[model samples]
Target: MSSRSTYHHGDLRQAVLSAALDVIATEGPSALSLRDLARRAGVSHAAPAHHFKDRAGLLTAVATEGFDLLAAALAQAKDLKDAGVRYVRFATEHPAHFQVMFQPDLHRPDDPELLAAKERAGAGLRAGIAGVPADGRGPDARLAGVAAWSLAHGFATLLLSHNLAGPIGEQDPEEVFRTLAGLLFTSDTAQPPQE
Candidate 1:
């Protein structure tokens, strides 16, 4: 009969989170307010607080969800290059989650669930790097992993901000990333500079 009555009979927590995602996607995370989310979800203002406690709590949940999703996407990759492509795709698809995820100040950094999700994402990236064939020099896997992540994350950020639209006109982002990954991960390029 009424908005409040309808929300009360439905999934208020998910409704609030969905509304919050919409706000973050449209206006950025700084614009997210529990009151606004509650209004959007047609629930009592206090209903969101019952699930999230505060803005930081809600953002922590969003970050956790983002990391979990990223981990799942990475886990499905056939190889290191594919993992980089998947990372870019995940960022583009989940801009709201991506925005809140890396900004530690926007969410509760010490949250256990958030930490676990972050670890899972990190492990997936590391596993992808480990799958790469060694080139006799035995380059540090940790540095290689960081390189892969930086390439994907930087490319995704640039694409999301529309900075690559000119140079990459009409070219598919995933194909570009695959080529970039192939070049960087090759034996010659991956080696340390000779002294």
Candidate 2:
């Protein structure tokens, strides 16, 4: 098939991307295919190949888009606590994107757009760490930052996977996260338990 797009529909590229996301959300990423996406987007079978060389290229594009969205979420945070909450929110809101973004084997990590977006997201995470006040007694900022991220990411992962509902009891995930954030912000060294 020619590299040129065969789609005459409006925003065919975006439509395909949206369809890919829908498929990922419903059937998981393993079931995604260019022909399937084309059918979902109401485009020719070769149209997706024109926009994306293959499945990996399409996944790379999705990962890049995901990182851009994550960066935006982190940038909107008011402080470290807010950043943690936002991180969980982003993961929960974009489960399909979050899944593909972390699975490097599924996409081309060296792609220019992917690299830039990853850098932007990393910068946003680091900026949130920078906003926290330096603690006395030789607190390691890098360690603290990692710990903060681990807590939020772990919690979000558990919530998404339905592993937290039992422990969460009557409290929602966001409420539990808010309490956890308060503790982290108030303590000099706060780390969630490993289970």
Model 2 RMSD, rounded to 1 decimal:
4.9
Best by TM-score: 1
The TM-score measured for candidate 2 stands at: 0.88
Q: What is the lDDT of every predicted structure here?
A: 0.89, 0.86
Candidate 1: deviation at residue 50, Å?
0.2
Question: Candidate 2 at 81: error in angstroms?
Answer: 0.8
lDDT of 1 by residue, 1-195 (tens): 575584573788888878888999989999999998888887777778989999999999999999999999999988898899999999999999999999999999999999999999998898888777776676588878888999999999999889999989999999999999988886344656879
lDDT by residue (62-172, candidate 2, tens digit) is 999999999999999877888888989999999989889989999999999999999998888887788666646445778878888889989988988889878997786
Q: Global lDDT for candidate 2?
A: 0.86
